[model samples]
Target: MISFEAVAISMQGRTLVRDISLSVMAGEKVVLRGRSGSGKSTLLKAVVGGTPITAGAIRVGSLAVVPENIQRIRQEIAYISQEPGMSRETAAEDLLLPFTFKAHSGKEPTAAQIEAVLDRLLLDPAILRQKSATLSGGEKQRLVIARAILLDKRIFLADEITSALDAESKDAVFSFLLESDHTVLSISHDPEWIGRCSRVFTIENGILREEK
Candidate 1:
């Protein structure tokens, strides 16, 4: 449900991505793999309008990723970065914060739903009571995923979200996402994550090349 056409991104006069074009269909999972500076993350950010494309176009569903529609477009997409930002509140409060927004009012996840997501991610339900600052890196990552799940956004832009987890936790996170019907475009170096995806693309010198 996402398409990029002849997309190029530059910042501060430095070109980060060039002439990249691709489409991610609904319910399909795609992975982007590359070295540190290869622009995979930048491409993901561009899809969410976090980084503006200097050339060409991007569209989510039927809406173009332009200034006017960006805010609405973002509501349909969950862009999870390598380090998810969290407030100093308890985990439960952080998770519930989104529902307080007018956009998601009355859509708060029930306690059972929250517990179920935590269980699937191998997290303890009690974690909801702990302060976000006290959670470990992996805990924070899983919690971020849980929040996204609660939002029920169908499009996911995940950037190295599994980097901090151990094997079991990593598998748990991967399995949950894989089993879901979300349209995922992710940046990851994890072999298992890449292997489970339906398509893989690698970025080289700012160009996107689909890997066979």
Candidate 2:
């Protein structure tokens, strides 16, 4: 489970999230919807330990997202931002980049696994050889998601990943994520995306409010 109690986040002396508490169980999909700059993305970043909390507590499963436990928490969760950073030139290399890290070394997936994930996302196998910079926004989004799937992460924090996807691609991506056993905390404004969530949260003036 993911739990946040009395969580408050302040950056540069300005509070972006104030005393927010939320809980989401495994396999539960939740979306945060609100006007832009309303702290939706900030809350997601806080859960993943990318943003420091000024107060309160955060726990993902039994591991708390404190400075001491950050490494462990990072290993268990996958955070996808709107613009994914790919250091490699080719798509396949980008997908396999994590394995190059010491923690994931020697766990690089087989070619068959990569192909299977791309196929599931409706991406052409030829894209594997394409330059990452040449791909469109929608293609990049799908590729990042495919990489996350190959890593076998149990928790996903998605920030407007489908904003640039077409209807068919969006459906394909959503279908893949929803079918997984992972817990999801997403920041999205798309109506279809919001409708797919099991729970909805809204943020206003740094306060979190459950919509349903």
Candidate 3:
């Protein structure tokens, strides 16, 4: 489970998320919806320690989202941004990049697991050998999620991941996220995504308000 207690985020002397609080249990699916610049993405980053919180605390089970615990917490959670950031060239390297990190070292998944994940996302198995720069937006998103799942991550922080996907790919991604055991905290405005979530919260003026 994840817990946020009076969390707030500020940047450039301006507040982005203010005094927000929320909790998510295991296997729950949540979506943060708001108009542009409502700090939806910033909130997600705050939870993962990518953005510094000005106040309050965030905890992923027993691990807290503090500077000292950030690295450990990140190892247990997968964050997929709206723009997948695979470096150009060496798609296989990019997919296996996380395994090279100290936290994930010696945990490289088998080739069969990789192939299974790609097929589940409707991606070509040969994509692993292609250059990362050659992948379409939808393909990149799928790849990121596939890598996360293969790592056995139980928590996901997703930011507009389905924005560029076709209908078929979008549905596939949605089903994978919701059907899997991973607990999802996503930032999205897609009607379909919002409808599918078990909980939805609207962010406005840096405050979070649950929507019925």
Candidate 4:
């Protein structure tokens, strides 16, 4: 679960969003939409300690999103950016790279686990053999999603995750996200994806409101 209590974000004498009090329950899939630069990204960033909130606070599960809890909060949340920066000699290694880290050691996914998630996301297993740089935008997006799924994150904070995907790929991505077992708060402009979310929110003039 995630909670924002009277949150306000300001940068360089300008306020992006203010008075944001929201509670996303466990297992809820919420989508937020706004014009570019309306601070939707900033809101998600705050959840992972990327951006600082001038007022109020945010909580992930029982942990507060402070310096002391940032690392732990990050472990519980998968913060997927709009365009994930991919850098692996091959797509196969890309999936295996995180496991090399000390923190993620012993968490490497097995072949069966990898194959299952790839199929669920409609990705061809052959793509794993291709050069990571050669994969299309949609493929990269799906690969990133696959990585998150393999990690078994409990919460998701996705930012314009499917912006580069085509209709068919977008449908597949939506299916995986909505059907998965995670608390999700995504930012997207796509009407179809927004309609599938349990709730929709929009921010304007530094205020956040539900799109009832």
Candidate 5:
């Protein structure tokens, strides 16, 4: 449901991704792998308009990633970065913050729903009471994932989301994503994560190439 047509991304006058084109079908899981600075993350960011592309076009579903439709595009996708940002409020409060917005009004997940999501991610419900600023990196990542789950977006852009998790927690995160119907385009160095994807691509010298 996402397509990048001959896209090029540049920052500070230097091109990070050049002439990259690919398509991800609905319910498909794709992984991008490369060494640091290979533009894997930049390509993911481009899809969500986190980074601007200097050339070509990006489309999510039937909508183009342009200034006018960005907000609408964002509504349909969840972009999770490597270091998910969290507020200083309690974890539960932060998790519920999105519901406070008019875009998500009246869709607040019930307490049981919240608890079930936390349980599915192998996170304790007690974590809800903890200060977000004090949580570890892995906890913060999972919390971000929980927020996305609550948002219930069907497309996910995940960047190294499981890098900080323990094996059990990583598996928990993986299982949840694997079982979901979401279309995922992720950047991961984790072998297990890459292995589960139906398609894999590697960024090399600013170009994207599919790997079997």
Candidate 6:
């Protein structure tokens, strides 16, 4: 679950958003929609402590998103972006490379598990051996998602993840994130994606409003 109470994001004297309050319960699929520069991305980034909130608080599950808890919160959330950064020289097989870091050393996924996610995402397991620089944008996005699922994280913060995907790939991603065990908070303007979510919130003129 994610909670934002009276959250405000202000930068360089230009207020991005203010007095925002929202709660996404466990096992729920929610999406945030807004016009360009409406602060939807800012609010989503705050949930993972990537952006600082000027007022109120943001919490993930049982932990507050503070300096002390940021690391733990990040470990629990898979923040997928429109263009996830990947090393040009690395092979796709090294998708789980982050697990090599001290903090995630013991969390690497098994070979069989990696194969399963690849199948579920409709990706060719053989692509795992391809150089990261050679993969298309859609391919990279899917691999990023596969890595997150293999990490066993329950919460997903997706920012226009389907932008580069084809219709079929988009559906695969939608189903993967909307599964019963996962909780999703996505930033998307796609109507199909919006329709698939259980609830919708739109940011307008620096305020957050629910579609209800």
Give, for candidate 1, the lowest lDDT window spanning 10 residues.
Answer: 164-173
Candidate 1 residue-wise lDDT, 1-212, digit = tens: 99999999998899988998899999999999999988888889888888888999999999999999999898888877777788858988887888888988987877889888888789989888999888877788788888888887788888998787777767777887777898999999988788999999999888899999
lDDT of model 5 at residue 160?
A: 89
Per-residue lDDT tens digits for candidate 5, residues 1-212, read 99999999888999898899999999999999999988888888888888889999999999999999999999889887777888758998888989989989999899999999898889999999999889887788788888888888889898988787777767777887766788999999888899999999999999899997
* Residue 190 error, candidate 1, Å: 1.3
TM-score, candidate number 5: 0.94
* Regions of candidate 3 where Cα sits further than 4 Å from its true position: none
TM-score of 2: 0.95
Per residue, candidate 2 scores C-alpha lDDT tens digits across 50-157 of 788989999999888888888888877888877778778998888888888998899988888988999999999999899989987778888888888888888999
Global lDDT of each candidate? 0.87, 0.86, 0.87, 0.88, 0.88, 0.86
- For each candidate, how many residue pairs have backbone atoms clashing (under 3 Å)? 0, 0, 0, 0, 0, 0
State, as a TM-score between 0 and 1, how close model 6 is to the true structure: 0.95
lDDT, candidate 4, 1-212, per-residue tens: 89999999999989999999999999899998889899999999999999999999999988889999999998888877766778889999997777989999987888999999999889989999999988887888888888888888788888988788887678778888887777899999878778888999998888889988
The global Cα lDDT (0 to 1) of model 5 is 0.88
What C-alpha RMSD separates each model from the true structure?
A: 1.5, 1.3, 1.5, 1.2, 1.4, 1.4
TM-score list, all predictions: 0.94, 0.95, 0.94, 0.96, 0.94, 0.95
List, residue by residue over 49-151, the lDDT tens digit for candidate 3.
8888989999999888888888778878899887789974777888898888887899898988888888898888888889899888878888888888888
**TM-score comparison, 5 vs 6, better candidate:** 6
Model 1 residue 120 lDDT score: 79
Cα distance off (Å), candidate 3, residue 204 = 1.1
